[model samples]
Target: MDPAIEAIRTFNRFFTRHVGAIDARFLDTEANLPEARLLFEIARQEPVQANLLQAALGLDRGYLSRMIARFEDRGWIMRDRFEADARTRPIRMTEAGREAFDKIDQRQRAAVAHDLNRLDAVAQDDLVQALTKARLLLDPDAPAEFIIRSARIGEVSQVAARQSILYAASHGWGRELETLEAETTAAFLRRFKPGREECWVADLSGTMAGAVFLTDEGDSLARLRLLHVEPFARRRGIGGALVDECVRFARDRQYDRIILWTHTVLDAARRIYAHHGFECIATEVHHEFGEPVQGETWQLRLTA
Candidate 1:
């Protein structure tokens, strides 16, 4: 299995348990998780159309219908007909529904606050940042933007360290990967060329979102190395943008072609490269990252 898949699953398990998602009734309320979430969404989008509500929350039409019926039976909600759209009635909470929702909302907030209060101030802030990043990464369709800039002082090491840390934690990759990243980073910095070679770091509002290095191999050849996007920043086109920057620079420098080596497990990076016109030219299976991995070489020939 891909390490990314495992990492996501692990996080999902931990987070669901942490938030009491497994409880029969959420926060000891009368509703389950799905019911509570739909109730909250309905309240948030007051006077929402039933169709629009189902689409927004992605609840099954049948399930939504039943839940609405249940709520109506409890006198917690009602539908109002308006002349604006005669096709369907708009759904809204009754006075009792609002009261119930408010009580549950207060209890949920208090529960979260109580848990947060157990941690120090710094830990609480860290948790918030982590959650925000995770949410962004998981939402592929969400709007996002990142800036590409030259690697700064100390950032070369920072990029390499992050690569090591991420791979080690996600894939059970050992220190060999760490040593290799450190060595390559050192080489890039030691033989740095102002224009002939470059390293670009993706910046997301002062955060290190990703990094890629373009190296000038002798004889008009270029090598793209160490391309990665932080997990929270993936699916946001940062990887493709980095590859584009490389191609642009290689063309500017008169390189004949660009080559990159990456594992088959990196499906996202591979797709980004392929979308940018890079083709897989060769592959070999090896046990470099504590498992049998198919290492692939991708190439893109520059056109004059």
Candidate 2:
């Protein structure tokens, strides 16, 4: 099996076991995990159509009908036919069912708290971030909340380290690239100007997803440097967001032109630049990052 698939399967097994999801009773409740989940969903989205519930949970029609029948037998829920559509029935929880759901919710919250309290604040945050990213990956259609903000203290080092590791892993670049990134970041910080130079970090739902830098190069010229996005966070318009932020900042600072140096192999970044009206103005061959590679300079003219 593929490593990714195996890893996911392993995590599923561990999580199911950890949560007692395979047990006959969930959180010591009378209902099993699936039944408890169904009850909670009904309580949360009451008056929701049975078809909608089935679609949302991806449950089989027959299986869902049986679960609904069980809930009805327990006097926890009622299915009422829609006035306009006899075939469509909405599910609602009874008073007893609502009470049961509340109890289950309390118990689940307690269980989660018990587990999370074992970890420190940082570990809890890491767990939450990991889960959020995993959920986003599983649901590509979900909206991603991205923020382009000023780089926080110590974040410049983070940017350099991330860029170095990612380039090394993906493109087989060597320590030369790492050294260059570190030096550039350090130099920018040493000579940083509040209004003229800026570094922006792209944050996606509490995770540092990407970063970019803009520096004054004199004579109305601004240089864009060290543009990078995390590999897993690509294709989500993060690269574009970073570039857009750079251009906006440059224009606000009254720079006439913005320039950047990048290699030819960075097709995605190049595409984002081109989309924002940047033109390639220079090219050369450089063996700075281990292997021979074509280097290109892209420039964009800022309009007043």
Number of colliding residue pairs in each model:
0, 0
Per-candidate TM-scores read 0.56, 0.86
lDDT tens digits, residue span 1-304, model 1: 6998999899889979877788887888777678788789889998887788788888888998888888889888888855565227888899999987888899889989998999997688668756657667667455666799998788889888999999888777888899899999999899898889998999875557899999988989999999988877876788888999999999999999999999888888888999989999999998766678799999999966
- In order, candidate lDDTs are 0.85, 0.88
lDDT of 2: 0.88
- Taking the tens digit of each residue's C-alpha lDDT, what string does model 2 give over 248-289? 888898899999999899998899999999999999999888
Candidate 1 regions exceeding 4 Å error are 1-144
Clash pairs, candidate 2, are: none
